[model samples]
Target: MIGFSCYLSEPADEQQTAYLKQMQQAGFTGVFTSLQLPEDDPKTLRQRLNHLITSCHQLGLAVVADISLASLKRLGIAPRDCSGIEALQLDGVRIDDGIDMTTVAALSHTMGVALNASTLSAETIDQLANAKANLRHIEAWHNFYPRPETGLDPCWFQQKNHWLHTLGFKTMAFIPGDAQQRGPLFAGLPTLEPHRGLLPLAAYLDLKRLATDHVYIGDPQLSPRSIAAFQAYTSDQVLLIQTQTADDRLYHLTWHNRPDVAQQVVRLAEARLEHIFAAPEPHHTDERPRGSITLDNTRYGRYAGELQITRCDLPADPKVNVIGHVAPVALPLLDHVGPHQALRFKQ
Candidate 1:
């Protein structure tokens, strides 16, 4: 199943609501909310935090809250803050700094949430594993600023692949800039042969196929032609999509004529990939909740609900509300349109 990260903006009540609504409309099930603790009183901060969680749950979104190690360090917080995990009932916590394994393990147990450590080294991985950190995943940050020369280095690529496999960690890689710039790297991989057909369907399909299950494609000025090409080529595969925005900007990198573009893209993808004939329509068990429909088809399930939409079938949503905003029309088409364009309407 595909997932999204809501890190382009900051957290707020209104932003959270809008983010959740957009995720549901887009058929996204998981969200990674970036956490930036407020400087208010701890009690007030707790209230705000609780409100954020409640808001996400109401929207049926799985919550993966991020706690930047760098931010924590800047605030002079201790590694033992991981023990304070019980305060926030998150599904997962992202330790976004290079921290020791023992600290990570302690935090994981204290919080009872999976750990996502970002951009670490092989030495770091071994140390974490030795310290018994129950890391759910690891993401390499190298791709954020991909240098063509560095990316094309066979020795570097081989070493990175070996390290990832050796660490036994699920990996996620981001592709910087346009898909065309990254297509060669994507096409160069052998494991991606099966997904070559889906290549022309989406921008950077080859990279997505070769990298981990999670792929980030960021280019503010991605053209509609490129987007159309991507959609046409990768109709068969499940892919997570997100609009890119910078902290200083109020709009997304990819400008659109309407807000529903993102939603439309998500809807079309869901309609195309969702198994129409899987099981009996999913019964509305308590687990399913109200205003939500879970459809089982293909290898994954399609969760459609007023509060959230998820393909992974996880019980929670992980989207975070960022401070930035994009034009309502700036969203991908999947957020606005339904299967076969039958449900095309404003959200």
Candidate 2:
């Protein structure tokens, strides 16, 4: 499942509500908010939280709030008694370190509960099981690191996710958004350090490969370009590649990787079909770097007009014309294009 953050630190206004709707239309089905801000006025926090939850409910988005004992007290709801919580129409509550297992287990029966993925231990899992927690409503959620170097190591994260799967627990992680990053430390919230600067989709794909069941945008918003890319991906199963420059003949058409695949580059299957495009005379035989969009020149015989996206750096070849390059921020996506995957270029 894909989700995005909608913090309550600011007022829940029409703008924020509209963003929720935009995100829902873009294929996001969940909203994560935090009610643990101690600095905010309690009354104001309650009002904002209520408004946010109402908007989510109306939009048919699942809403989960990160809660602490103080925040719960501010809302005048006792943790053990879930009646108040149910009335608020929350889909779930993320329990922090201080919350006891009995409470966590009890909350699971009433609503969804997310436990800290990083600190969860075998003993704690045993305790939750012994307490008869509703396993179906419980998931492990990794915290997003606001500090640059504190994010979880990718290898450790993958291993931990594997362990969680063995124990029948769904897992979630965060990736930073491209716009309106959260304040105090704007360095991006990510579960893996390397993901801190990646585009939202690239980081999300990485997390999926790492065995995460759900991915959330840690920051407040995504740039328009990122949103469009995600929309294309979710709605059409097409990988959108932003290029510095592209030949309109190739860029305008959706190309698919050859069924047989290639080790060093993405081979466009239709590029070599007869009458697809005019055989190009070699003009720009620039060195083929990774992410370069290249077309086979007339000197390559029947292979002329064949198009390929380089997967690794290659020396300049007279038979190939380097046409364009994938945007640097999007280079990470080159490694993920699978056999027969559809690719569309955006200049």
What stretches of model 2 exceed 4 Å from their correct place? Answer: none
Q: State the TM-score for model 1.
A: 0.45
lDDT of 2 by residue, 257-323 (tens): 9888799999988878645768899889999999999988899998888888999999999999998
CA shift at 243, candidate 1, in angstroms? 21
The pairs that clash in candidate 2 are none
lDDT of 1 at 122: 61
Clashes of each: 48, 0
Give each model's whole-structure lDDT: 0.41, 0.89
Per-residue error for 91 in candidate 2, Å, reads 0.3
Model 2 scores a C-alpha lDDT of 0.89
Score every model by TM-score.
Answer: 0.45, 0.97
Count clashing residue pairs in model 1.
48
